[model samples]
Target: MPRVPKIIPISDLRQDASGVIKRVSASREPLFITQRGRAAAVMVSMKEYEQTQHELEILRLLARGERDIEASVGFNLEAVLADADALLAEQQ
Candidate 1:
């Protein structure tokens, strides 16, 4: 599991937004921002943000694998049949 960074409330951010931004910008980790005691947003350095986005994309791709199988997107019947024939020939 990925590590969760420190959480900051929006009210505290209003007091010193620059400092908070600077701190989060300097640190590669993400800062969770909460609204009404619920997680509302996240602040992270540009590199970290991009990395998070890439990870999410990979997760999305993996999640779609099952759907791809259901859709029979890349099923090669001829290739499968040839391989099965070869296997049976070898067994014989």
Candidate 2:
């Protein structure tokens, strides 16, 4: 079963902006904001927003790696793994 999205009108948001923000932050769920009975924007907690940005950056890096592979440009896999191991050991 699909879960229903949390939707709210702009006026409701305006009337209880603080409460709405609290609910979104506590629930860690997105709140859909509608204007003129149409979709306008989506609100998410700061942590969620930051996490999404981080994930997107990782995806971008993976895509870049793929492109590099296609162009036959990359470091040796074993050397890279060894470097990664050394970096991890330094933190420990």
On lDDT, the leading prediction is 2
What's the CA RMSD of model 2 in angstroms? 3.4
In model 2, the runs with Cα more than 4 Å from the true position are 78-92
What would the TM-scores of all predictions be?
A: 0.56, 0.83
Give per-candidate clash totals.
0, 0
In candidate 1, how many Å is residue 33 off?
Answer: 2.8
Candidate 1's C-alpha runs over 4 A off are: 1-5, 35-39, 75-92
TM-score of 1: 0.56
Q: How would you encode candidate 2's per-residue C-alpha lDDT over 34-75 as one tens digit per residue?
A: 999999999999999999999999999999999999999999
lDDT of 1 by residue, 17-84 (tens): 99998898888767889999999998888888888899999999987987888888866889999999
Q: How big is the positional error of residue 35 in model 2, measured in Å on the Cα after superposition?
A: 0.4
Please report, as a residue range, the 10-residue window in candidate 2 with the lowest summed lDDT.
Answer: 2-11
